[model samples]
Target: MTLYETIFTRRSVRQYDQVQLEASVLAEIRQAIDNEKQLPGQNARFEIVNADRLKGVAAPHAILAYSAGTDAALANIGYTLQGVDLHLQNSGYGSLWMGMGKPIEQSADYRILLAFGKTSAPLRAGQGDFKRKSATEISNEDNAIARVARLAPSAVNFQPWKLDFSPGKVVVRPDGGGIRKLLTGNLQKIDLGIILKCVELALEREGKAVTALTPKGGGKTFAVEVAFE
Candidate 1:
């Protein structure tokens, strides 16, 4: 399946077979990560490591994300790596976004990790298998983009963002009050980026040319605009 199709069937896979992937497979994974486009004006770095280099994670491999602490940087990591998350699962591997996992070696810019490896777990049957808020609750308009984009995962399953659709573009903004206090870390910003990838992929599948992924604002005002034609 393509990344967009994978979105409907993907899940946060926890159980793994614990076998390290072959060098060729890991190379392909790295190639995908290296080629993932970042949001304009943001630079995020990703590193692939083995199980021995990590703590608090069971997967045999991981991709460590490093970036500045700014809201745009965090969201760029989310938006970019989410494509890797989908690609891994779409290729029959398992993946999970790990907030608590860490690298044995520390770096000042380290932000988060995506744990992935071979697994026996099954992919979700489809969108029906997702336990998420209804379209009416998460989007201003009920449509295909909202349906696929709402499946984008968030920290603690908070789903703390909403979508507003307009001609040739869609704007995503924080959904409810008290999100910052409730989600102490900046994971919510990353969630915005992740969903932005979903929106972009859905648009591409519909034959729309995505002209830009514009991330703006900070604090309670954070938002992302996906422009297409």
Candidate 2:
């Protein structure tokens, strides 16, 4: 499947076959990581490690994502590694965003993990297979961008973002307050990055590019404002 098609079919696979990944497949994954550009202005790192290096994850392979403890680091990793996640799924491997998994190599920089390998789980047949928020709920208008962004996976599936459209801009913001806010404070930022990737992909398919991404000064809640030219 194409990467774009994989976005519609991908599922978070937790159970994996108990076998090591072939060297050829592992090399392709590594190449995908190496070729991928990091999120602009973020210093995130990616590495493939044995499942033994991660705690509580049963997948035979794990991609340990590391980043400096900067404000945008976690979200950047989410945005960057998600490409590899989709690529793996397109290549017939299973992948899961390991937000809660612990790494054996203790480092302050280790931000998140993606457990991936052969699996028994099935990819969805199409976008209709996803249990996602409607486009109208996630954005100002139910356009193509909002429709795809609605499929972005988030922490606890909270879908904690709202897209507002202007003349030449698309503003993404955290949605909700109280316990939900506290529950997904940092994770929602990462969630925003995931949604941004979906927006980028959707726009790219229509021959548009993000002209700029500026961090709006409202602390961590409203992470970024994206302009498309």
Candidate 3:
């Protein structure tokens, strides 16, 4: 399946085969990460290392992400790695976002970890296999982009975002209204970036050429404006 298609079926895989992948396959993943485009101007660093360098995760391999601790920098890391997460799962590997996992010799730049390795764990059969908020709960418009984008995973499955669709653009804002404001701190910014990737993919699938991804505001007022043709 394509990365966009994988979004519906992707799962946070924990169980792994414990066997390491071949050198060639590991090299391919590393190159892919090296090539993935970040959010316009943001620069985040990623290191693919064996499980020996990691703590807390049991997967045989992992991607250690490092970046400045600012909101845009953290979100940029999330937006970037979430695509890697989908691609790994689509290629029949298991991946999980591990906030607690870190490089054993950690530096201040380390932001988050993505644990991935060979696994027998399965992907969901389809959209119904996912447990997420209803269309009415997370979006202002009941459309394809919002439907698939809402499927993007969040920290603690909080799904703390609001999708507002207008012609040629989609505004993804931190959903701080009502009782659905579960996302907080640095993780929430990252979660917003995660969903933005899904929104971009959905737009591209619809033949919309995304012209820009402009992040607006900061802290509680954080939001991303995805402009497209």
Give TM-scores for every candidate, taking all chains together and pairing residue i with residue i: 0.96, 0.93, 0.95
Q: What lDDT would each prediction earn against the true structure? A: 0.89, 0.81, 0.87
Model 2 earns a TM-score of: 0.93
- Residues 1-229 of candidate 2: C-alpha lDDT, one tens digit per residue: 6666678999999899999998988998999988766666876888899878888888999998877755467667777887888888988889988778878779877877889999879899888888888999989988888888789888888888899987778888778567877886767777777787777787777678888866564554556687887
The RMSD of every model to the true structure, in order and in angstroms, is 1.3, 1.6, 1.8
lDDT of 3 by residue, 117-222 (tens): 9988889999988889887788989888888898998877888789988888888987744444433456777888899999999989999999999888887777
Candidate 3: pairs in clash? none
lDDT of 2 at 22: 87
What range of 10 consecutive residues in model 3 has the weakest lDDT sum?
176-185
lDDT by residue (tens digit), candidate 1, 1-229? 7888899899998889978899999999999999999989888989999999999999999999999998889889999999999999999999999887899999999999999999989999987898899877888999888888889988788887899999998998866567554654678778888888898898888899999888778887888888899
After best superposition, candidate 1 residue 92: deviation in angstroms? 0.8
Model 1, residue pairs in steric clash: none
The pairs that clash in candidate 2 are: none
